[model samples]
Every structure is written in C-alpha cells, then in structure tokens.
Target: MTDHIGTAPVRDGLHGGGRRRELAAATVGSVVESFDWNLYAVLAPYFAADLFGHGKGGVNGVLAAYATFAVGFVARPVGSYLIGRLSDTRGRRLALSLGMAVIAVASLGLAALPGQRSIGVWAAVLAVVVRVVQGLAFGGEAPSVAAYVTETAPPRHRFAFSSVSYGGIILGSLLSFGVLTALIRTLGKSGLENGGWRWGFLVAALLGLGAVWVRRAAPESEEFHRARARQRPGGRPPFLRTLREHRRSVFTVFLNTLGGTVGYYFALTYLPQYAAAYHVIDKETAASFMTVVLAVVLVTMLLTGAAADRFGLLPVARIGFWLPVPAVPVLLAGLRGGWLSFQLVAVLLGMLVATVLGTLNVFTGLLFPTEVRAVGLGVVNAATIAAFGGSFPLLAEWLGDHHRLGLIPFYVTVCTAGPAVGLLTAMRVPSFAAAVQEAEAGIQRTPGSA
Candidate 1:
C-alpha cells in the first residue's frame, strides 16, 4: 500500500462515452507511434539502398540509412517541447490530433519520395527531413496521449486503462510485420526489393489520418481544465521556471523509462532483423516468430496492467527491470544459438521487460501536476528514447560486427539497473501527487531530501 501511489483525485470529469473517447485516442496514438517508427526499421533492408546508397552498397548502406533513423530520435526533443506545451495550454485533444497530422504528412511524403538513383544525396537528405518530422510529431504525440489516458481513467482503474490504451503499440508492430510478410510472400523477394516496400508507408499514412480523426473525437481531460482555471487569467507562468522547479521529475522520468525503450526497440522491433542477420533464420521465419512473440507480449502486458491495478505500479515495474538483467546475457551468451535456443530467451525477456512499458507513460505523466504534465514528460521521455531506443540497433550492430556480443548483456543490465532505485526515490519517497499539492500550496521541501 505504501509503494502504491494514489491516482489523481481529478480523474475523468466526463464519464461513459468520454472514457471510450480517451481510450480510443490513446490506442490510436500508440498504434501510429509504433507503425511509422517501426516501418523504417522493418523495411530498412529493402529500401535502405534505394534511399541511401550508390547501388548495392552492402550492409554499409543499411547502416547509413539507419543513421537517419537515429537522427529522427534525436529530433524528438524539439517536437516534445513545441507540442507538449500546446497540450498543456490548449488541450490534449488538439495536441494529439495535430501530432497525428504531422506524422500523416511525413508518411505520405516518404511514400511518394524518389530513391537515390533519381534524386542523388537529396533522397537521403529528404528522408531525414521526413523522419525528423515524425520524431517531432511522436515526441508530442506520446506524452499527450499518455497524459490523456491517465487523466481520463477512473482512479482505481488507472493501471488497467493505461495498459489497454498503450497496447496499440504491439498491435501496430504486429500489423506492420504482417503487412510486410504478406508483401514478401505475395510479391516474392524480387518484387519487394524492386519497390514494394513503399506500400508499408502508404498504409502508415492512411492509419495516421484515421488516428487524427479518432483523437479529434476524444474528449479533453477535466484535470487540465481545472489546472487552467486555477491559472491567473493572463498570467501563465514561464515554462523555463516550471522546468527549473520540476528538473528532478524530468530526471526521474529518464531513469524509469530508458531501459523500457531499449527493450522495445532492440528486443521487440529489432529482433526479426537481428535474427536474420546472424543467420539464425531468414526474414520470413524471423517475422513469423516475432508475430507470435508479440502476441504473447500483448497478453503479458494486459495481465501486468491488471496486476499493477491490483498490486501496485512500482512493484510490477521493478520486476520488469530486473528480469532483463539475467535474461539478456543468456540470449547472446554464445551469440550463435538456434532460434529455439537463445532467441527464445531473448523474446521471453522482451515480454517480461514490456511490463514497465505497459504503464510507464501514465506513471510518468502522473509524476507531474496537470499543468505541466505533457511538456515535461514529452521532453524527458523523448530524450531517453533518443539516447537508448534510437541508437540501440546501431550499438548492437557495432558490437556484433566487432564480435563483442558479450558486452551487450552488460549494456542492457546497466540500463535496467537504475530505475528500481530511481522510481522509488523520485516517485514515492513523498509521492508525485503529494509534491504537486505542496508546490501549489506554497509548501517548500528541499530538493533530494528524504
């Protein structure tokens, strides 16, 4: 009970249909986030040279293409600040809808883009431009959607609501894989290689448009309205001051989420590629294997979300961090095991580590007061994703290329190690809701003191 922080008293001012609207918005946002981001990762092998190379530049071309992928992650902080600020001041619905529209435009542009053969280096340049746009959109989209779901859920069901809403990440990735696999099979490898990959982005663009409509239909949170009501009409506080005051919360969000991002990008999104690259299986088998693994992960996420509601968020999340410490080392121990051998262990860890992700957005959003929840979370989580998630594949490939696979487990362990202590210290020593109340009431507590 002590570890279980209480939900906000201002949960969901609107009821019934309003709750459905919030959940739908959150789910669609998660799906779009997963789809467009992973579309590149999934389709990179086929399209990387088309967009980045001088023709059959080998693995080096793919590597160059993914650099743009990393750049996109690096661009997220800018979007987070711009759109997160919008979410807090205007409304979550507007921010969510706007972010989706950005991604939709980016996706459509990428789908229509000509390859390097036609456009030269500008093709790659334009690719980064599009990805940066997506990163910015996602940067804002993620936090706004997270805050909306958390604020709109009933207090007792916050964990479950957050879990169910964010489960769209898995659904999105699954659909991505399914789409690609079907394309590979129907078109055969040559047809896909020729130009079939663009269809994936075309699909992502359509989904982004649909998500924008769904978010528009979703209701705004009562919590944000109340926070705005308390604000002096023409006297909004400067964001710089809010950042300075809430610096501790931002750092805490970093510690809590860094590992989860790595797990999702590496263990889940990158697995099919990792397996195929190492000769463990062909792309089709790897994709099929991951589809099954992700289905299990989805079920596991829902179960953990329900568990968090029944037990507590931190208790459930602590297991998520520690489970990967041992599991990851075993996966790459020999670095050449069969699919049923070490690869299975890797996917298992994927499912387990995802528990933290199931409720992470909601937990992070709740760590701030309603007034600044979207912006702070957007910035910190985007930074964390940029550092860990975006660069994970590159790091793994670099280590594997140099035959240093053994160190990867240590890297994953180090990432997961901080959160157990940091979340307990930062979120629950005095608690987030408590800190927000104290700040509002002009009660000062020294930073970092227990």
Candidate 2:
C-alpha cells in the first residue's frame, strides 16, 4: 500500500519485515494462479476428447487435444518478451497483476466455452486461444515472481526466498491433486466427463480471485524502487544486448531450466497419462498416487529451499543435476513393472526430480539482475519449457502409441543431461558472478538509481 516509487525508503519495516511479507504475498498469489493453470493438465485426458473431439476416433481425438496442449508453450517466449518488457519498463507489480488478471479472465472464459457437441471445431479453436493467453500469463508469472522474491528478501536469504516462487508450484500441484480427488469422488466417471471437468475449471476461476486479494496486499520491491530512483542516463540495455554480452550465463540458465522442465513434465505431466495408457493404474488410482506424490513434492520443495539457503545454489543445483541420471532409468522400470511397484517408484522418482526442480527455483532467480530478471527468467524458461516441457506430453503419447515406450527413460536421460552439463560448466565460468554485478551496475547507473 505504501509507494516508494522515486526514492529508496529508509531501511525500516518495509525493507525488512514489510518487504518479506509483501514478497510472501506475491508468492502466495503466484501459487494460486499456478493452481488454476495446472489443474487443466490433470483433467486433460478426460475432457480433451469428450469436448474437443471431432466425433471421429474418440481416443485419437483426445490425443490431438493433448498435442494442441503443447502449442501453448510456443507462445511462451513471445509472451516473455512482450510481458517481460512491460514489467521492466512499467513495474514488476503492474506486470504481475496484469498477467494474473489476464489468466483469471482466460480461466473464466474457458469455463464458459462450448464443447464439441455444441460448437464443433470452434470449441477446440477457442480452447487453444484461451490456453495461449494462459501461456502468455504464465510466461511472465515465474520470472516476475522470482525477481520480486529475490529483490524483496534480505540478501542472505535470497535463495531461500526465491525458492518460494517454485514452492507455489508445488502448492498448485497439491491443490490440483486434492481438488481432483474430491471431484472424482463426488462426480464418479460419467459425471467427470459430462459435468465435472467444467466444474473443475470453475474451481480454478474462483481460486484466481485469491490472487487479486494477495496482490492487493503486496508491497513493491526495494531494488525496483532503487533502479527507478537512480534515473541515470543510458542506463537501459536492449534485451538482446544483455543477452549477447552474457551469452554464457544465458546458456547456463537455459540448460539449468532444461533439466528442470524435462524432469518435471515427464514426471508430473506425462506420468499419469502413461500409467493409465498401459493399464498400470486405473484413473482413480493414478490420481490418488499423483496426489500423494505431490504431497511429497511439496515437502521436498521446502527442504530444497532451506538447503539452498544453507549450502548455496551451486551445490544444491549439482545434487539435482546428477541425482536424476540414474533415477530416470529406475523410474521407467518401476512404471513398466506393475501398478503397486510403479506407484511407489513413481513417488520416489517424483521426489528425486522434485529435488532437482526445487533447487532451480532459487538458482534461476539469482541468475539475472533485477532490470531484466523477468525476461531473462522468462526467455530461458520459455525456451527450455517449450522445447522440453511442452513437447514432453505429446512425445510421450507418440512413443507410447508406437510401442516405443521403452525409450521413455532414454528421452528423460538426454534432456536431464543437457542442463546438468550446462550448470556444471557454468559453475566453472568466471562471468557468473560478473554477470550479476554488471546487471546490478546497469540498474544503479539507470535514471533515478536508488
């Protein structure tokens, strides 16, 4: 509620308790938004064919819907550039509020959309369009939240605070699995496809309003205010210029991001579908396992955050880096074996991957300076997410249908290795620290530097 737009306020409550509180508020809002966005993926298989199908091949139509699901990731970089620019020039708070508003509206719109029986192909088109809007909002959300947390928290706790941004993700997963479990219990199978899915979206729409309340309570970050106060000449760096100069940092981030995306999507997004397809688990059982796994994921997320604080980002990232190399193969083996063992192994794999991703929330937040943090996070995340996260489901679906299911672990291994190598190399680079210093320097030299 207090505005310190043109000057750095005295390091009083706002810089201390007030700032952390506001950052926490922002993180809470982000978690709610993520819950809304991700809830759809869990329910996608049920709704996609039912509503989006062309009345042709039922399951095939559903598969097409999943493919369309990947299309949203394509817009992430575009959204990152557009939204990230707006956040930098305008303000992180404004950018986030606008993004959340857009997502809220999109969720409500999707809730109201007509199904295939009612509108035919247009329904599918409408769904895709709304999803693209959601993707755009998401593209901005992660970076904006990460930047806000890092800037607002005390320097010593930067990694700890930033981890909260991804904690929101785990929170979302928890809410999603919990909500779906309850819905399935009440609605039963037919109710699920016929009316339950729509209600699920409605639940997301309602949760979105919580973001508005949280953002309202959020106080802006000191770093942003500081940058604005300096008001120095020629302080702004073109996005591309920043990238060109810090090419290695950017690559490291991309790779770091890649590892998280592949591991996460493979475990969270594709696993349920894979389990159901192979009859390894029934729909309800799969949902239950997912819910339980997510609970474990939530716990690991917090531990990883604390770990980052105690140990630092590099070491934590390294653990995440190599832990999954062996874990991936074991994960697939469990899935292929049987339902009971697969569920147990699935949870274990989820925990391992969760640790890797949990580490990322802090490290990636620290990667860029406040000036372009949103976009930097956005670009790297967008690229890696699009390449790995978005394509994961579709690829898994294809591989499964073609009887190439054995390749799943190999695919995960390849993707996981990309970021592992990138991060390890980045640890050795001289410019990693310099990059952060340069970014901060640019901000201090900017107009009205705080």
User: Evaluated with TM-score, which candidate comes out highest?
Assistant: 1
Candidate with the greatest lDDT versus the true structure? 1
lDDT values, one for every candidate: 0.76, 0.71
lDDT of 2 by residue, 324-433 (tens): 88877866776777634657777887787777766565456555666677786778778778778887878887887788877878878877776678776675545344
In model 2, the worst 10-residue window by lDDT is 1-10
Model 2 gets an lDDT of: 0.71
Q: Which sections of candidate 2 miss by over 4 Å?
A: 1-17, 54-59, 231-234, 338-340, 428-431, 434-450
Off by over 4 Å in 1: 1-15, 54-59, 233-236, 334-343, 433-450
TM-score of 2: 0.88
For model 1, name the residue pairs that clash: none
